[model samples]
Target: MTASMTSPDTARIAAITLTFLLAGTVKGVTGMGLPTVAMGVLGTLMLPAEAAALLILPSLVTNVWQLLAGPRLGALVRRFWLMMTGIVIGTVAAASFIAGSGGVWATTGLGAALTLYAASGLLSWHFTVPPRHERRLSPVIGVVTGLVTGATGVFVVPAVPYLQALDLKKEDLVQALGLSFTVSTVALAIGLARASAFTTTDLTSSLLAVVPALLGMWAGQRIRGHISPATFRRWFFFCMLALGLQLLLRHLI
Candidate 1:
């Protein structure tokens, strides 16, 4: 149902609008962080699965814009072919599992893992598999990430560290993330399709929320430059930590 059709609770409406605004703003500034940020915040207000479903279309659309804009697209594809291959395999495998037997335990486990990852970043601990070994290891990362995405709709964390180690330019990093998400989104769509997760109602809700999400991105872009890089990084990690804890608690209790 449309927001208006739902019982008019002014407070609830304002909260959802604000959430969408923030989600859009983050997307505009970072190009790929909206779903991560939005899901974290929205999870507090809605079911985590529902929040993730809501983000799928907008994330796909936003990332498509980035993937088309990046330079060296061909080079990126060539270099990461194995990673992509692994992601496809892993995503498909994990999607099957999710389709068959999804539950609170799986989601809670994902939340805990995400929290640990964020905490590691906060503590400045890094995991490296060495450059010479990257080819072999990269695919493993892809598989893990894909599985996480299949199960929880938040697989970006797995790729983040490896991407950071590449020392790419800021724009390239953003583009790479967008590309990564593009792959995951495709995989997710397939899974959702098989599970019959996308109903007329789901699509209707997703389409209606797109405007708010886009608006939030625009606002976030305007403010991005004003914030320091370090501050942004810290805030991102903090949000991750908070999101993880909340998810854990939700499943536990």
Candidate 2:
């Protein structure tokens, strides 16, 4: 509804576009920041559920590609069934309970989650979940990850670390993240629908947002060819930390 340039809504539309562009670029280079970046910024401007709704289509599209592009898609599914089950169930349940409520708790939850994510990145913490204990720990991790996703529209944090801990090959790790995100996206959509947080307009906006995200990904890939990854990641984490702090402060105050 706010798409016109000179219709008194130019600034808002511009902000949304810029946010999506930046979110896309982050994901393009970092391979996992679209939803996190988008939600972090958008949550400041709108309800958390609305922000989550806007990311649905873009996140689904990117992660679907990420999932399909990897080796052993079927094999991976078979291997991670328990974890996947927990994620789906937890996301659905949590979202059903927390959806459409963007009060202090939601803001603080998102902020805390962001801080935790950034801290891990800042510290370069690599928690390793050994193969022997993978099955035992995965379901628990999946449930927690799903709860976080349901609450904040972010599916990384613990899930990414859990996947990283597996110590899979680099490519495999990326694919695993994709798989997990794709599933989370689907469950999130379902939960939003149940909570009346999703609407036709939101779906349309989300679909349109996919364009900027993909374009940014292309640009980011080109830029990544020129920049130092270490520098980029450090900046990314710091930025996330700052935004997290702001959110927390706003909520606490």
Candidate 3:
């Protein structure tokens, strides 16, 4: 690999670190959102493929922490089995596809999709597909999520809104995110391995960067308790919309 491609410059490293710190803080405070925030910001600096690879380890670690910290892990697991299954299948398919053909197209598409979703959330415009006889929307969501996860390394968008629509309890939402990430990360790692994207250097860099991720998560957790849920949701959706639009514009141009 060429120096420019393999060895990210100091500015890039600095940007990644700062972004992760912010992501960690948001996730810690809200119980989830690190990848969405980080991916959107980092896409401006690095290739989408690189950003996805960089986030793998940090996302894995943070989700692990979230999963273990919860009190009713087993119950949450049971409640969201259908959702989890969809995420797993969808993520694996997406990851495999991207591993073979990673580029701006995937990133741009992901950004556009996220922007639309975030805008809907911010505007309080909900899209509901009625469950007709023999409907299978849950697995479809899972498959789409997996595909997106494979392509962009961001799987939360597909599942999050659907879960929210269900009006699941707060803890249930958190647990579902945790479970989805864990499964998606595992699929991502395998896909990366097959693609030969995980260099020794990449692994080292990811390890070194873990500190910032942890710090951000801790910071987020501390502030999360103070904010009302409605306010948090509003800010989060706004941020997602802004980031998604920024990425889409950058890639399109």
Candidate 4:
């Protein structure tokens, strides 16, 4: 390995730290944005697979914490089993091609996904999934979400929207996001490993990233009561929209 690979320069390290710090804050305030924000920022600096590799440990640890902190693990597992299964299948199926494609199209796809996510949030689009139709749609949404995760290293979009449409109580919805994100993180790790994108160095980097993430989360939590989440969310989505457009243009041009 080259010096650059073995010992990341101070500038790169600083960038990564700042990226995770901001991402963690987003998660802390919104309750679900670490991976999304991190991926978006890091994707600008590295290949999609490399960004995904850096994401594994931090995303997994935080999401697992989110999962365990919630009230209903078993119940949520039972309720979303099929969707989770589909996520695994879809992620595994797409991983090799997406993660190993040198990130040409992967970057484009990530840009597109971010754009869609930002657009949906900014528009405040809401769709209700009746209990009766949820069973049929859940697995499909899970699979699509997984595919998107595989390609972009970001796991939002259809999944979050689907969960929100379920009419779940507030706490349950948070827990559900935790569960789904945990599963997505695990599947993504496995996929990246299989693609040879996640190595020991990547693992170490990811583990270290957890610190800034948690610290940012703490800071965000401290200020959560001061700023309205809705106002923050609106601004956040707008920023994301601009970032997404930039990514798309960068890759496309």
Candidate 3 overall Cα lDDT vs. reference?
Answer: 0.75
Question: What RMSD value applies to candidate 3?
Answer: 3.7
What C-alpha lDDT, on a 0 to 100 scale, does residue 48 get in candidate 1?
49
* TM-score winner: 4
For model 4, how does the per-residue alpha-carbon lDDT over 1-253 read when each residue is reduced to its tens digit? 6878756677788999999999888888889999989888888888778888888888888888889988999999999999999888888778875677745788778888899999999999999999999899989999999899988888996899999999999999999999999999999888888888788999999999999999988888887989999999998898788777877888677
Distance (Å) between predicted and true CA of 12, model 1? 6.6
Note the clash tally of each candidate.
4, 0, 14, 0
Residue pairs with clashing backbones, model 2: none
Minimal lDDT window, size 10, model 1: 96-105
Residue-level lDDT tens digits of model 3 in 157-203: 67777766666567766776788787777777766766776667777
TM-score of 1: 0.86
- Reference-based lDDT, residue 196, model 4: 82
lDDT of each: 0.72, 0.85, 0.75, 0.88
> How high is the lDDT of residue 33 in model 1?
67
> What TM-score would every model get versus the actual structure?
0.86, 0.94, 0.85, 0.95
List the candidate 1 regions with Cα displacement exceeding 4 Å. Answer: 1-5, 8-16, 96-100, 127-129
Q: Show the colliding residue pairs in model 1.
A: 24-216, 24-217, 25-216, 25-217
